[model samples]
Target: MPVALEIVSPEKLLLSRNVEMVVIPASEGEMGVLPNHAPMIVLLRGGTIAIHEGGKVTDRLYVSGGFAEITPERCTVLADEAVPTSELSRAEGERRLSAAEAEYNATDKNDVPSLDAAMDRMQSARAMIEAAAA
Candidate 1:
């Protein structure tokens, strides 16, 4: 049986499909969810969401922060921001990475919130770039 996966952002629903498996970037680490998986809610980090079907990866999405609810039949992702890897341009990713690095460098080392936000942006950009390359 395939699992129903939905990825939504504040602005729109980015994806709604049935996937054989999904790999999410959980705050604790990476998590792979399959059909009939145990129910849980996890905090997502900035990274790629790999969608698998028929033992092959069908899609990759870059998600920056969010929460995911997984159950036996479905997985729902409420993302702070979600961008399809196919839509993210290499140049755009590079620009975002550079900007984030610059901001991180300029911020005070003691500024935890600013540093975290900058790091998140950098990670998201890098994930997007990597996804694009693959």
Candidate 2:
């Protein structure tokens, strides 16, 4: 049985389909969903979200901050930001990661926003790395 799965962002609906499996980046850790799975609501951490269907994979998405709702019939992912793994350029990811690290190292103790921005950049880069690897 395939479960309905949708991954949505504020700007648009990234994916909507029926799939065999959906791996969620739950707040505590990773959680896999399949048809007839138990119902639950979960907060997601920043990471890669994978989907499997029809013995083929559509694509991997690097999502930052989200919530997941899984039911026996459907799986829904609401993310603040989501970008396809293929969309991430390997060279860009590496370059951005380097810049973020450098910025983080240069930031002073009171520059919270700068630190956070740097962290987000690094996280995004890491997600791209994971997606590309997969």
Candidate 3:
């Protein structure tokens, strides 16, 4: 039995397919899910989600943060933000990185919330760039 995998963000449904396997960037670590896997829910971190079919990686997506629900026959990811690697451009990534850096630099050091948000954006932008390159 193939596992049905779905990835969604606030704006849209990123992916929906019956994949042979999937590797998610779980908060605990990378978790590989195959058909008939046990049920669970996991927090996601900033990283790639690899979709495999016939022992080969058929697709990859970058997700900033999310939660995933895993069951015996399906996996669903509700992401804070997500983008397919193929859709990301190097130039756009660079632009985002630069903008985030500039914002981070301008923010007051004493403002913890702003600093954290800026840092997260910087990291997400960097990861997207890397994923696009790969």
- Report model 2's TM-score to 2 decimal places: 0.74
Tens-place lDDT per residue, model 1, 1-134, is 99999999999998999999999999888999999999999999878899999899888888878999999999999999898877778887788889999999999999999999899888877876776676
Worst 10 residues of 3 by lDDT: 120-129
* Candidate 3: segments with Cα more than 4 A from true spot: none
Native-referenced Cα lDDT, model 3:
0.91
Identify the runs in model 2 with alpha carbons over 4 angstroms from their true place.
99-121
RMSD of 2: 3.0
Count of steric clashes across candidates, in order? 0, 0, 0
lDDT of 2 by residue, 3-47 (tens): 899999999999998888988778678788999999988987778
What residue pairs clash in candidate 1, if any at all?
none
lDDT by residue (tens digit), candidate 3, 61-125: 98987899999999999999898888878787789899999999999999999998899788777
User: Given candidate 2, what's the lDDT at residue 47?
Assistant: 81
* lDDT of candidate model 1 versus the reference: 0.90
Q: Give the lowest summed-lDDT range of ten residues in model 1.
A: 125-134
lDDT of every model, 2 decimals: 0.90, 0.82, 0.91
Model 1 lDDT at residue 52: 96
